[model samples]
Target: MDLKNLFNVNGKVVLVTGGSRGIGEMIATGFVSGGAKVYITSRSADACDKVAKELNARGPGQCVPIPADLQSVDEIKRLVAEISKQDSHLDVLVNNAGANWNGSFHDYPDEAFDKVISLNLKRIFTLSQACLPLLSAKASNANPSSVINIGSIDGIRVPPQDTYAYSASKAGLHHLTRHMAGKLGGDGILVNAIAPGAFQSKMMKATLDAFGDIIKSKIPVRRIGSPEDIAGTCIYLASRAGQYTNGAVITVDGGAAVSANL
Candidate 1:
């Protein structure tokens, strides 16, 4: 077996939720460049289409855009149906679509909690269920299908902000990944989660802009995450190199998880 072939994902079919930008886009780009046919989804049709077009132009593989707001069960079902029409089997599913909210502990609204949980936690479960049949169709003992959940370091430790619901949702997602891996392992499906810390994304831009230097100073690695940091981890999980790595929460933080923040 050639060593480089272990990381190759050529000809695989992959779906990345919220692939219009940020970590999802990074992973989708990696998959496309590595020669995997990728389907990217987001709430904004225009954004999804634009990303698909850009990725396709840069790919040895192809990218198809499917826009759907995955905040409701109906939307997830519709998104799954759309994929079913295009392909019968799915080799990989990346549950990267998520939402976060922040507020003072005294005045945090119920709606905000529900909104974050609905998108971050509930939809991941529903979407994974919807995609299971397709994933299982292409899965086997020798070559298992992959499910990559995007979690956050906030889930693993206390955060500096007041994102209560966001933290809770991601923590739940991490546990859910383990449970799904245990249950699905028999069916030839590998489930894992990537807990990222301080990446440059639309969601984190405001916070990073305000305290990037302070944050970096506290981190042992003395820097935030990058697109390549996420893309590399994603490629590993999706490729042959990570077939046996099941039920794991791989933290892609720059030593933040273990650093002493002062």
Candidate 2:
């Protein structure tokens, strides 16, 4: 393959949770557009099925939709089981399914905090464990599998919002990525986290809309992250170019982390 082809994700099997929309959809689109066979999942069956069809038309690649509620370990296991029925091995697993909640620190409910942690942090552990067999089936020195977690910049710095649980969970996930990378490296599986700043997605639409100019002013790039920014980062992580990269937390904020701290 040529040097430029090192970045290609073609012929790989990728699974992206919460792939119906937002950052998850962007990642799936990039992989599929590059010719990787992708499997997308979400709580909404209609949304999953819809994106699958749309992505299939994008390139030589194909997409499969697996509608699943990843709120618990059982559901995560089921999602993996469903995947096993289609392919023997998975080249990439993107833990992108998550939720955010906000409340006054003094009044944050226990269940609300638990809910964010459970979904954002706990389920990733379960899903990764469940996908181990598939990940290892064809893993090797030349072609290792990858576990890419979708983290947020909120984890790195305190945000203006009162989303205590969301921040804590993402911070935990970043550390967990390093921990998993160390443990899974021997198995030829890389682990990494992407800490994205403001982005143009439904999740950040309201925030950007309300504070578009302000957010731009804070970011050195004077703009929000695009689908390419997030997708390209992940493509590098899952492709041959990233085979030696492991246990890294890549911050795709365009210098927002620096400006925001100032």
Candidate 3:
């Protein structure tokens, strides 16, 4: 068994939600570089198109953009339909789209909580279900289809910040990954979650900008996450190297989950 071939994902059909920016983009970039035909979706059509163009320019593979607001079942189905029209099966699905709302416990609004949960947790479950056929169609015991959920360190550990809904939704997603993995394993669909630490994303940009040094000091690695940190993890899980890994929540947080209480 060649180790290099074990990590290869060349020509695999992949879809990555929220791939226009942040961690989603990071994962998509890795897939594209690894020669996978990647479809990236986000709410912003222009951003998606822009990213797709950029990725395509740098690829042995191709990137296509499909913009959709995945907060509703209708939109999720629509996205699935779009993909089915172009491809008969999907090799990997990255549920990376999510939202966060921050507020004090006493002040957090119910509407805010609902909005975050809908996008972060509900959408992931619904979208994965929607793509079941495509995922299953390409799955086999030797090369199982992959579902990689983008969880957060906040889900595994209580953070100092007041992001109640964000944390709750991610925690929920992490468990959902396990549940789905168990249910889908028989069909050769391996499900896993990546719990990431602070990274340079649009989501974390404001906080990092405000107190970069302070945040770095708190983390055991003394720095935030990088694109390579996330991209490499996704590649591992999506490739033959991680075929036997199921129901695992791989924390790529630079030890933040363990050091948070320190």
Candidate 4:
């Protein structure tokens, strides 16, 4: 295989959940640019359709949007069935749809904790289970099917902020990625995760506003994350370029996790 083709995703079929905006949108764009036919999903059909149209206008790659709530298992089942009909073999699955809520531990409601875990942890497992058959059917070492879970920096190191439930859920997800990787490696389905730091998304902007330049100055890279930071890592994992990488949590943080507070 040509060196260039190692990073290429031509003719591959990928599915990305919560791919309408933020990090998810960047990943979708990267796959499309790499020549993969991608299908993206979110709870909002209108948002998904709009992004799909925008991405399709960019290049030769095609993108389809299917609206489904990742928080619901039934919705995932139906969504997977529809996708199976579109492609008998799926090349990649990006489980990026997740939610987090910040609250004081003493007053955190049970509903809030459950909500974060349900979508972040439980839904990820469900989606993987649903997509396994398709991934296995298309498995190959050179371009093996992949599962990329979007985790958080909070999971790896202690959270600077106090999103108790969010931190716990992501910590669990980090472990889950390793567990899944071991169980699925023999099946030719590579499983991995990307734990990102502060990014300029709707979710992180709020934190940025509160912390300002102090947040950026504290990081080793001295800047926040960009779409490319996420998109590049995600595409590499999904393509043949990352064939040997599995069961790893690639941290895309700007060295925030390693910096000593003292």
The sequence of per-residue lDDT tens digits that candidate 4 reaches over residues 119-186 is 99988999999888899997966557999999998998788676888888889999999999999988
Q: Against the hidden true structure, what lDDT does model 1 obtain? A: 0.93
Misplaced by over 4 Å in model 3 are none
Stronger candidate by lDDT (2 vs 4): 2
Q: Clash pairs of candidate 1?
A: none
Tens digit of lDDT per residue, candidate 1, span 71-152? 9788889888988998999999999999988899999999999999989998899999999999999798789999999999
Query: Model 4 misses residue 180 by how many Å?
Result: 0.6
Model 3's lDDT to the true fold? 0.94
- Candidate 3 lDDT by residue in tens digits, 55-171: 999998999999999997898999999999999999999999999988999989999999999999998999999999999997988889999999998999887789999999999
Candidate 4: how large is its RMSD? 1.3
| Candidate 2 lDDT score at position 215 | 89
lDDT of the candidates, in the order given: 0.93, 0.92, 0.94, 0.89
Candidate 2 segments exceeding 4 Å error: none
Model 2 misses residue 45 by how many Å?
A: 0.6
> Which candidate would rank higher by TM-score, 3 or 4?
3
Per-residue alpha-carbon lDDT of candidate 2 for residues 1-262, written as tens digits (9 for 90 to 100):
5698889898999999999999999999999988999999999999999999999987788999999999967788888888999899999999999998878989999999999999899999889999999999999878899999999999999889999999999999999999999999889899999999988887788888899999899999888889999999999999889999999999999999878868
Strongest candidate by TM-score: 3
Question: Could you estimate the TM-score for every candidate?
Answer: 0.98, 0.97, 0.98, 0.96
Instruction: Flag regions of model 4 displaced more than 4 Å.
Output: 260-262
Judge candidate 4 against the unseen true structure and give its global Cα lDDT, from 0 to 1.
0.89
Q: Which model is ahead, 1 or 3, in terms of TM-score?
A: 3
